[model samples]
Target: MGDQIELNRRYIPRLPSQTQTQSKRKGAGARTWLVVSKLGQVSVEELGKQTVMRRTGITAHDLRVVEPELSYPAAVLRRERAVVVNLEHVKAIVTAEEVLVPNPRDPRIASFVYDLEFKLSADFSATMTREKAMEQLPTDTPPEASGSRREAKMRYSKPLPFEFRALEICLQSVCKSLESETSTLEEEAYPTLDQLSAKTSTNNLKRVRVIKGRLVSLTGRVQKVRNEFEHILDDDMDMAQMYLTDKLATLQHEGVSEDEMDDDADVILLGTDINENMSSKCSTLFASDLKPNVEELEMLVGSYFVEIEGILNKLSTEYVHDTEDYINIVLDDKQNQLLRMGLVISTASFMITVAIVAIGFLSINIRIPLFDFGTYTQWYEAFGGCVVCSVFLYIMAVLVFKFLGLLG
Candidate 1:
């Protein structure tokens, strides 16, 4: 029994506890609840209040106690051996990683960290090995590994599961924070590349979820837009399939006419008297029509054929042009994102350079005829002035770019 207990304890995850009660309600009486769950099978409710109290280092009495002096009603609840935090004081739940917000009322809000979780899977180690091998393997090794080989492979293995798990948790925290904000945005709310690039938040809001046997990020709001577009594309394909089916049915019904049959054909010879009479009439009509049909019929058919071809050509050209336009639009968006990223990097580099220059400048002592500027105090003041100017310029440039719609 003791050994079993130890084994179970070894697998149990360590819980990190943090508690914050709202002192006051801010903006629209918004209440944010942070829910932690595992595989949707476990909820906070399953975890008893006592367990939470133990994990969080809060006394059992605190769970039952109420603090009316605190501005908001807050409590911790356990579900499925996990903790749930209910907060009525938070105006927004931002991710712990950087999130790009347009036209934020307060810049300081950008730094707000969100709590989230990351799930680490055992398959990641194998995936890493496969990726590394692909990058550095010899020509003799197969590009793809078989299931048996994958199971047996242990090259470059490292025993850092704990570290990897911790890192995964940290990443998860970032993803969750980003996801909260993204969920609030509409599907069509595509941030421009510039906006995405200019975003300097350290919080990441996303979670890794397994779907259809694939691991995918479940955080960003942009994924909804992608799904919406995919749905639209599927609908279009369905419509096209229905249209083609209708066209095929019409073509099947309007196949070759009886009058076009040969005089001594097997079809006519094998038929009954009624069919024979019909065949005879069709043959007579065809013989009479054949001579007169040559000139006028050919010209009419030729003219219609030309018009049909012209229409087809026009449609093909339009389709090509539209496809090209779509490609160009996508390329332009990519280019814009790259441009914005470059700008941000350039700005950061410039600021860093200014800082370095100011440090060097401050370290120097200057002696002037009009004034004695040789003192460290004077140098410090000059460095401070330079720093202030540099910061001012950075702000101005950012604002200018934003105003020009070059920065989001």
Candidate 2:
């Protein structure tokens, strides 16, 4: 009797004392409940209560939220348990982890992220008991059978199962990566509007390329999320995820052949044809329930989407404008400097021309000082003076230009 009691205690999961459960709930400041189940028949929004209608049919994808008070890590024993008893609820808890961002410090990480995770229903652990099997056996059943049953019970221990932690951990990691990006953009790497109004430099040019690349990356992340949601939503049949556990139970109660389950291909074919018939009902209910939620999430992300859009648009616009103005300023300065050099060269040319004309007259028999001070000198001397004056004029022009810091 002692051994039997010990065995039962080891196999069966114990319930927490009621007092402890109440005290734990009281201490926990806030709680969030999400509907993880996807039975087309059940909806929290439609029902409007803490209670969800219990349905026997459940899947791993149906886990909704992680209860803060629940010691989720301790409960989940993946190695020990082949299948969770209420695995759908466990999956809901897993889904909850991915859907909500625990710490939403960065606005760039959209309000929520959601994705479907599928597990093989066929792989679930066996729930049928040895007691039930024995009741159906004949009185002549061998003693060895009981020994085998005990050995099987000892070997296959039931695990204390809850939500899988990996899903949330992965999503949170991505969000953290996103938050870092957003924070970097909002703070250090990007310049403010006022700084942008300042002179453009090589540094600004570098920043332009970096900002553009960042914009592209962020856009890709958001789009990827959008595509995921759309892919699920577009198929009304898949979106409904109607697991008719009760209906199947009812059918079983009506004496349907047990062999029907083994013929999977036929079941799938029949289900597809029936699904086609029931499409309208499922689609209507699913669309009505899901569209608002998807849209609401999109709406929350809508602001951030617009924000990224605005940032990209703003960055592109400013980059072009600043670059254009910088190029224009540089070109204008070059043009003016060229004109200054031309004016100086032209003045020197004019002086040289005047001297040549005077020398030409002196060369002809007009042996006179070009600017007479009432004295006569040799024609060669006057000519020599004219040549010196022209050379001097050219040198002076070069010096003046150099002094003004314009020629270079």
Candidate 3:
């Protein structure tokens, strides 16, 4: 009976098998997945346990968190083609629609779409639709409705079309994060000219402009796709100015915090001084604080250089052709002068020969009382020497005039 009891104990129904227990434990530890989609297409899968992104058949590192004060794991992802950042890390999200309107600050008019899902610990997930994402709200609103306003505000001022504006805003956020992070790194984390030049079919001409004080550096390719969409008008120009004003305000706020942390008011004071100086300079140069579109400004400068080059080429060609014609005319005049001189020399030589022959004939035909061979020969030689010297002097004068550029 005891043996039977032992067997029954071993086969108890209350306890599971070792294998079954192990399988259950493994299943419990399995990580949850969050689907991140753009325009109804899955772009990335976020692993809950690892807090890492899995995309394009590859797994990347966890994004770096800048501000840990937020409730979520807000981070900045710096990738090869784009930057990805969670909006939760942002201190504040401000939307200035006044900058977008026609009469005020003309911001780049764009349409945007966004769809974000929040997955909680209890397998409960809620999604914010594109329509909800487009609405601008006060800072105290619930997280479920905000929909990346911090990132969206940076790129656009007005409502955009679904999916299109979302992608652009995301891209712009990524670029801003990259610029901010790279400014702190000691070594270059991006591609160099050598690497960029060697790649095939690489769009190397594109660049990202990083503004620090008065200096700007182009760090990434200005996407050709974005260029196709950028059309600036007076409204856009006004919007750009407003954007700059908004950025300055944000910078001042952040800078004040940093200054407080450092216990040094010098940074803020210097910043103010610089601002005053810049304002004065801008007024002197541009006559207004309204900023121009940088891309349009660059295009204008490039067009000016091209036009100047064309004008210079035309002028150079005309000058060269006219110079050649003038040279040809001068050369013809020199040739005529040489021909005239030769004709005079030939006539003088003929006359001297005749004179010599006549003198000889007169000596043979009639004996003159005072005439002698030696004296007559001497006079003939002297006259011949004078004619030769005169010809040499005339040739030298022509050469001098030619050297002085008087002939041409």
Candidate 4:
């Protein structure tokens, strides 16, 4: 009986440890996303690549541009149904009515996610309140009150589209991040450069080098973002494409078939006809109020472009390069002084060596006429003569160096 029990126990599988099970669950959750919509609805789900592609109606290639591991450049690609944004540290897919951000739990993006949700919710509530107030307005108002009503309606009705609001938030976040980093860099760089000027040291040099490298990197990023914005601003079609919400609303109101709407590229190709139809549909009273859709996006992007331009100017290499040049001049002066001192020492050493050789001959055991004639007194006088000659030679060497302009 005991042997049978032991065999059964050996065949049975052991369960995984509690920690291992928890870690597996945690890894699974990391791939999940927190999706937010303009209606203030929030849902958490494990959104795979195919699921996101299906949800946003974007191609796999567009989706991959915002993938966390790809390290893609700052881009804002307008797709058939989605706007793929891959700005610094903020990667998201924005559609007409919804936004899908991967890894929303990451500390880097958590604040953005929270802010987006709050703003959307607030906008929704404010919109509801505004609609209710409009409905409550009396139909038999006086002429002056009617005018005020028209003004109020105009003011309240022109809220930015959902996508533009989201884009605005993203731009604001990126700008704030850049501004903060720039401020920090300036703080660190200015003091370090100044200290380096006052007194050069290994540590201070390393700090300045790091600061300059940071400045160069920041400048590149700012320039890249500016170029992307410029590219969109220069192309009217690109800006129009970014108005995903407006296009969808227009197409739906025009009774466009689902098949036609599915391929936004074709819709865009036929935008001229659609725009005329939209213009005709507008009431004559409000027709004058209608503006080009691209105008809003242009103004939006242009404002940030100006902000980024200012940042780029702040990161100018003029100050850094000038400081570097000054440091080089100081270093060169010190090096030249070292070289001149070494030359002076070498010349004195050579003169002293010559004097030593002359005195050394007297110490030789070989017979010499001078040695035979010299007593101790003569020996002392000869030694004094050699010392005097050495002094003279050293002075002559210094004079030659001065004449050649090497002493300076």
Q: TM per model?
A: 0.23, 0.32, 0.22, 0.78
| lDDT for each residue of candidate 3 in 231-311, tens digit (9 for 90 to 100) | 222233423332322332333443433223122222222332223322333233333435554453334323433433333
Q: Return the TM-score for candidate 2, rounded to 2 decimals.
A: 0.32
lDDT of 2 by residue, 102-175 (tens): 21222332233232212211112131243345445555537878776666555554421112222332333344
Q: Tell me, by TM-score, which candidate is best.
A: 4
Give residue 30's lDDT in candidate 1 (0 to 100).
Answer: 23
The residue-by-residue lDDT of candidate 4 on 184-302, one tens digit each, is 99988988999999998899899988888899899899889888878888877667667776655554555654444334333333332323332233222133343455788888989
lDDT ranking, high to low: 4, 2, 1, 3
Model 1, 192-297: lDDT tens digits are 2223234422221111111201212222222332332233233322212212112222322444232222222223223323244323443333344322312322
User: Where does model 3 exceed 4 Å of error?
Assistant: 1-294, 323-327, 343-347, 350-354, 357-365, 368-408
Question: Residue 408 deviation, candidate 2, in Å?
Answer: 18
Which 10 consecutive positions of candidate 4 have the poorest summed lDDT? 7-16
- Candidate 4 has an lDDT of 0.73
Q: Say which prediction, candidate 2 or candidate 3, comes out ahead on lDDT.
A: 2
Q: What C-alpha lDDT, on a 0 to 100 scale, does residue 294 get in candidate 4?
A: 77
Using lDDT, give the best candidate's number: 4
Backbone clash tally (model 3)? 15
RMSD to the true structure for each prediction, in A, is 36.9, 20.8, 26.4, 13.8
